[model samples]
Target: MKNNKPKYNSIIDAAVQVIAENGYHASQVSKIAKKAGVADGTIYLYFKNKEDILISLFQQKMGQFTEKIEHEIASKQNAKDKLLSMISMHFKQLAADHQLAIVTQLELRQSNKDLRLKINDVLKGYLAIIDDIVEEGQQDGTFRSDLDLRLVRQMIFGTLDETVTNWVMKEQKYDLMKQSKEVHELLVFGLSGNTHP
Candidate 1:
């Protein structure tokens, strides 16, 4: 009921911008409310507190993110192509939204342990997408059967996560999308120095 309200999305979007500009610890509910063009009390209607706002922001953004990745990869016939599509979409989405990139890549990491745990819970859906791609690859012989699914998932996610963090730290002066293909290549082939056959 509350989610369907236009202000809910406005609050979420404002939170992203406010959090991106002011670090999560420094961001306040009143500031978010002002940016959302609503009274401070209005934010309380949609969120329990600032922590709830952070979690809800991640949930809303990452939910749309995972859905977009799913839609992008749906038509691909093989795991390799599907993986590439996923990687490209991941980079593209972040690259397109500088505020979101900063909030996710830099700001979110500053939260406390409990908040981090909640954020990790929000990430499972995105991670599961990676797990499925890895499982599909292994089953189809596109990936090495000996690979550990958990490790592979971590490697893929860690690589992408760190790359965006670096881009944000560097003030995003470079073209992140351009590196998608090379990053995909590195993940699929690795540092073995052997070209893909």
Candidate 2:
């Protein structure tokens, strides 16, 4: 198969770092190219513009992220374990990618409303994974019957997002994976059909 993927993945990676460090408003094509170790013209070969670059990066990384999570959860039979695996995978993935963590946690949010909306599309994969977990939990009678799956999904994502963002802002001084179990407990307690251990 043709390795038709971007000949300049390094450029995309550099763009991510540049955007993370410089913020979207301040990020420039020249800067990204420099960081990627390519001429500025090379970026145009793979991307139409800065916005396209950002969108592509998110879509690519998040897709791989979802795949890994899907594989991890598939190995578990219990919905509760699957849900925990899902959360753990997400936190661990972002935690390991410090540059990606910076871009997602802070810089990406700094984009304009239109850009944010586009970025939201890339995030749908992650969101859908959470929704699926909630559905599985409901089906297995582990979650509340009256639960608004959509709202519950948002709550789980929001809580986890906030947690990771705070840790990043704090310079990631602690272990992200170690904290995953506690988050699982909080979400499971509030949303699960049975609150008691």
Candidate 3:
């Protein structure tokens, strides 16, 4: 962490806030710099443009998220616990970072289709984690082998995303982690092959 790096990071943090509070189109470099408590030129030094900020923010935050989930899940003994831990962690992390959550869930998608496709590349690591867990469960006889792994990946991501969106839309009145367990259980219910339980 260099001194200038903190300022740059502050700019990035401010970018997330500005984009979250104001829509992406509404956010400007001066606005972000103002929120960041730095001059306008400081922002341009760290970011090429507004679009760069959004993509960099996603890469930086989502990278850390993927790393943390990978580390957390590694300690768990079974595929089920690993999968469940991942879901709980994903929701809880975003719930903690409200500004980033708002930017990610609301503002980022408001960008054009091309930018979103690039963001999806950043998302692939997180999705791959889910796919790995699902595959592990299948190998261990805990999940359905016949289920399409790609479809299962979408379900987990989609359900978690929808749950978080609902939480955000409701003004975040309830515990997101609690909702995480429910989401995970619903996912397990669908993915697991135990019909009689």
Candidate 4:
């Protein structure tokens, strides 16, 4: 519906930048409208309120993020390679967009419980991708057969999430993309460096 309109995207992109720059609490709808080059009323035409905008922004950005990761991993033949591709793409996407990284890693976490729940709903798609990869690995004996699916999914997603959070907290001082290989190795091999028997 309204999503196909150019202004919708403009508003979402503007929300990301404004929220990232101002912090979600300090960011006003008027500021977002101005950033989008739209009248304040125009924002309401697309969103119910500021919370709606935040949820929409996350849904839109994460949709694209999941799609890109899917595309990147599709070419890999093995679960290990697909897993690495997923991690690499995750790092590359955030590293390429500092504003988005800030909004996702910091501002979004500061929202209320309801808003956080909605954001978590948006994340389910991304988590499903990780689950698929882990299941593939287990099926092919690339990962331990005894591994708990839910636990493994949480570990993989948590590792990637925390890594990005650390990078953002440190002001992104180093190369996030460069850590993809090591992170992949850590996830695949564990601290003991044991391979599947």
Instruction: Put down candidate 3 lDDT per residue, 159-183, tens digits, no spaces.
Output: 8888888888787888888887667
* Model 1 C-alpha lDDT per residue in residues 92-160, reported as the tens digit of each score: 999999999999998888539999998999999999999999889888888888887888889999999
- Badly placed stretches (over 4 Å) of model 3 are 1-4, 195-197
Clashing pairs in 2: none
| Candidate 2 per-residue lDDT over residues 15-79, each given as its tens digit | 77898788887999999998888888988878889988888878778788889999998889877
Q: Give Cα-based local distance difference scores for all models.
A: 0.91, 0.83, 0.85, 0.92
Deviation in angstroms for 47 in model 1? 0.7
Instruction: Work out the TM-score per prediction.
Output: 0.96, 0.93, 0.93, 0.96
Clashes of each: 0, 0, 0, 0
In model 3, how many backbone clashes occur?
0
- State model 3's lDDT: 0.85
Error of 4 at 112 (Å): 1.6
